[model samples]
Target: MRTKVAIIGAGPSGLLLGQLLARAGIDNIVLERRTPDYVLSRIRAGVLEQGMVDLLDEAGVGARLHREGLVHEGFALSFGGAGHRIDLKRLSGGKVVTVYGQTEVTKDLMEARAAAGLTTIYEAESVTLIDWETSSPRVRWVKDGLAQELTCDFIAGCDGFHGVSRATVPSTAIRNFERVYPFGWLGILSETPPVDHELIYVNHPDGFALCSMRNPMLSRYYVQCRFDDKVDDWSDERFWDALKSRLHGEAAERLVTGPSIEKSIAPLRSFVAEPMRFGNLFLAGDAAHIVPPTGAKGLNLAASDVRYLSSALIEHYDTGSAAALDRYSEQALARVWKAERFSWWMTSILHRFPETGGFGQRIQQAELDYLVGSEAAMTALAENYVGLPY
Candidate 1:
């Protein structure tokens, strides 16, 4: 079998790319190592940049998002006992972010792909990119112990950081930049109402904590933990207690506690693989870059990557010009580096560092004080938070 393009992952980035390309009359096939249920089971980013929301709409899958997504105009940034509000909509010229889970986005795209009869192969094992350097690229995999292969014009490596897409490249051909944080996020999902309508980011002596949500009845919360921490180390009661200690004033008083339905520890890291294009194989989303999640840029970055890639591919097919395709890496990296800087900045300001000591903590608080007091500083934060222009 053969196709115009072969997608190596069924995650949001891959699905979004496939949907957009299909809408443009470009034939593409999506291959995933996990089942559909497994994909949706992974809980991820709960915020969307306006550009990403618009991209989903362009793909014809934004109806549910519009109906169910909670739109936020601002969020609370707390240091010490005081909470300062950053008016995202006001500071960013009425720009707003939608509080929608990444899981839901995947579900919507999956349903849309099924309805449109797009080709998506779930549980495809041992997928490999073959002859990607040559004009005719091929993808080979196994299903039910049977080998399958497809020859394609292009190979999209959307699999993820651990995926074969990026790993397939020779070490000498790629340059990698990575920073692994000393801490991880111990997060829990509870079936209780959120403490506040808007999300709250806390910087306290204990550590960094974030109050986020999925819906009215479901709350997502996170507190920084040691790098070696495990899921079993945090019980529901212990997690809630730790969360309450970090929160202050009304936020702590109004907080509602309940049984945790899901719990996990995610290590913080900032990574990027330079020059996202490897011959005929183009890497998009987590397969290309990763953010600390402090600035909520993970999913947004993926969506933006897909945006550039789809446009480039569409241009190539429509006009038979490879100029846009050739410049895909340089263009994508320009934006990727900016997002990386913002994410790194957010993490530095909001989290406790062992090496920083007391003097460093004072400096961090001083920076936050200046950030809230100055209009220019607030606007910069708001701009990055709502997302910079694609």
Candidate 2:
């Protein structure tokens, strides 16, 4: 089979790119190594930058999002046993974020793709990219015990960090930078009303905790844990007790506890692979970079990458100019580095470090105090939180 673009991985990044390219009269095929159900079942970050929301609108998949997504003009930051609010909208010149699950976004994209009859190969096994350096690149995979190949003008590597897309790049051709945090986030999804109408981020002596919600009744909460911690080590009662200990005042008093519907632990890390483009192949999303979830930049960063890539590809097809395509890696990396910095900074200020000792804790407290007390500092945080310009 031959196409204009061959996309590896049917995650949100791949699906969003495929939708945008298809709507722009570009032919693309998406290949996924997992089944549709497995893809949708994966829980991920829900916060959406205005830029991402607008992209969804452009792709014709924002109706449900606009209807169901919760809008937050501000979020609470707790330190010194008190909650402080950052006016994201006011500080960011009337910008706000939408709280919508990443799962829902994927579902919407999948529905749109199916309705438009776009080609997506699900449950494809052993997918590999061949001849990426050549003008005519191809993706090979097994479907139903039969070998198949797809040739395309360009290839999009939207697969996650562990996928084959990045693995295809030679070590010498790319430079990798990574920092793995010593702790992880132990999160729980419960069917109880959130303690606060807006999300609350807590920095306490115990650790960092976040109070986020999927809807009015579906709440998602997290508390920092050691790298060696296990989900089975904590029960619903223990988790709730620990989370409450980090919160203060009304936040702790108003919290509602319930049986967890889903629980998992996610490690924190910041990583980036430079030069997202490798000859005719380009990497997007987790294939090229990763950020700690502290600033909620993961999905937003992926959306920004998609925005740059789709525009570049569309420009190439429309004007027959490879300028944008040639500069794709440089352009994407500029924004990637900024998001990485913000995620790293947020993680540092909010989480407890094992070796930071008392001095480090005091420094973190002073930073938070300055951030909440100073308008400039607050504005900076709000700008990054709502998302930097795409």
Candidate 3:
């Protein structure tokens, strides 16, 4: 088989890239190692920046999102057991965010691709690329216990952080930066109504807790945990008690508890690899960088990469010019580093430290106090939360 562009992974980045390339009349093929059902239900990031929403709408993959999405004007910050709201619309000159899960976005794009007759193959395993130096890049793979190969004008590796594409790049040519936090987040999806009007990120002496939502009946919440803590260790009662402590004095009726449908322990970390492009292979999304999730910038960064990469690929095919392609790495990294820094800063301030011996606790309190007292600080946080432009 052959295509103009061979995309690896059927996640939001790859699928969105395929949609954009199709709009540009660039034929492409997408291969994902997982089943379609798994990809459609990968429960991940839910906050969408103004720019991300625009991209989805322009790409014609946001109909369901527009109809079912929750639009938030701002979020809340709670510290010293008090809540303060940051009016994002006022702070960002009318810019806002949308609450839609990554899984739903992927589902939207997948459905759109199917309707448009785009080529997306699922459960295609052991995928690899060969012959990059030739006029076309070749993707070789095995699917259903059979061997297969494909040729394409360029290869896009959006297979995420643990995929084979990153390993394909020579280790000598890659530069990595990483920071592992002492804490992790124990996230849960509960069948309960949200406790707050908007998302609430609370900082307390115990740790950090976030009150978010998936819909009117589904509440999403997370609490800081030690790195080695297991999800099984957090019973429903224990989880509710921790939330109660963090949200002390808040109405118990508002803190509705319900059965947890999903739970996971995510380590807080920041990782970035420079030069996102390697020969004919380009890495996007989690394959290139990872944010701490405090700023909710992971999916947004992936979408940003898709924007730049798709434009470059379209230019290359239409004008036969490699200028944009040549600048891909240098361009993607600029935005990647900005998100990395912001995520790190947010994670540091919001999470409690095990080594802090009381002094560190005071520092966190001071920062939160400053954020509430100073309009300039609140504005800065509000802008980052609403998102900076792509």
| Cα lDDT tens digits for candidate 2, 90-111 | 9999999999999999999999
Residue 59's C-alpha lDDT in candidate 1?
100
lDDT of each: 0.96, 0.96, 0.88
Per-residue lDDT for 77 in model 3? 82
Off by over 4 Å in 2: none
Runs of candidate 1 exceeding 4 Å displacement: none
Best by lDDT: 2
Q: Which residue segments of model 3 deviate by more than 4 Å?
A: 251-253
Tell how far residue 338 is off in model 3, in angstroms.
0.8
TM-scores of the models, in the given order? Answer: 0.99, 0.99, 0.97
Which window of ten consecutive residues has the lowest lDDT sum in model 1?
232-241
Q: What is candidate 3's lDDT per residue for 282-381, written digit by digit as tens?
A: 8999999999889799999999999999999989988999999989988999989988888988887888888886888888888888888888988888
What does candidate 1's lDDT look like per residue over 139-220, in tens digits? Answer: 9999999999999999999999999999999999999999999999999999999999999999999999999999999999
For model 3, name the residue pairs that clash. Answer: none
